[model samples]
Target: MPEGWDGTTRDPDEVLYEISMKEDQMLYEEFVQRLEFNKKKVAGEVKCHKYSRRRPDDGWNYMVEKLGAQAKHGVGGGWKFISLPDGSSRPLNDMEKMR
Candidate 1:
């Protein structure tokens, strides 16, 4: 139904790249909004902030330090860990194994 998909065949890589770009854009916008919220909280305009990461690699060490302090003061939310099943994960690079 979309005009872009009407009369052309797109390579899979091209479609994946577009999707990744869109995701990144959305995340960046959300990060900016969260930053503003944190600023307000720091200025005593808000009660608290739900601390979350902006990106996947924004210094885990710093995050750990912040969480540690928050927990010590009993002023932060908890964490959740999603576990993967053992022996159920398969290697992605094995093309022959896929068939």
Candidate 2:
């Protein structure tokens, strides 16, 4: 009885069902897109961490060597690694000194 409904038109229930199905399909597609985006974002973060220059490892031996060479010629601050009570060590930067 609606404006576009004619006497020969399909059942109203069937039309409503079809519209609901299309809406569900669209929502599913959007969910998939968002999932893929999150996957790519996580992958990019992993890649950046893997290639970052300041990543800590092996008791900061690499950092010590690199900073040592720079300090040997009096070029920068005497940055050193400090071991915490929790058994983890990190480089003592200027910001830490302020704290």
Candidate 3:
């Protein structure tokens, strides 16, 4: 129950805009629930993007394209995990006795 939950006769567009903003601020789990709730509440009118781990960066790329924004970079400028670590690093997926 936030400040603006009085259920007044405000503009529907304004309400939808606020709801969209709040949905964007929600966490991953909460976002999923909110999307489901909104989809049912709005009768499939509200649009959203659902991403899965299998397609990690596709949604990000789509957002960047839609919003006309530059891609984000990590501290090491998009380097892989092994590249971030110093010294001789072995693939965590590759497990074998170092002869």
Q: By lDDT, who's the top model here? A: 2
Tens-place lDDT digits, model 2, residues 1-99: 778766686889999999999999999999987787778853454244555577455434323323554365335545656665556667767865454
Candidate with maximal TM-score? 1
Writing each residue's lDDT as its tens digit, candidate 3 over 30-89 gives: 877887877686356555457535644422221111121443443322323222122433
lDDT preference between candidates 2 and 3, better one? 2
Residue 2 in model 3: shift from native, Å? Answer: 17
- Give lDDT per model, in order: 0.56, 0.64, 0.49
Q: Which stretches of candidate 2 lie over 4 Å from their true place?
A: 1-7, 41-99
The TM-score, computed over Cα atoms with residue i paired to residue i, of candidate 3 is 0.20
The residue pairs that clash in candidate 3, if any, are none
Whichever of 1 and 3 has more lDDT, that candidate is: 1
TM-score ranking from best candidate downward: 1, 2, 3
Show pairs that collide, candidate 1: none
Sort every candidate by lDDT, greatest first: 2, 1, 3
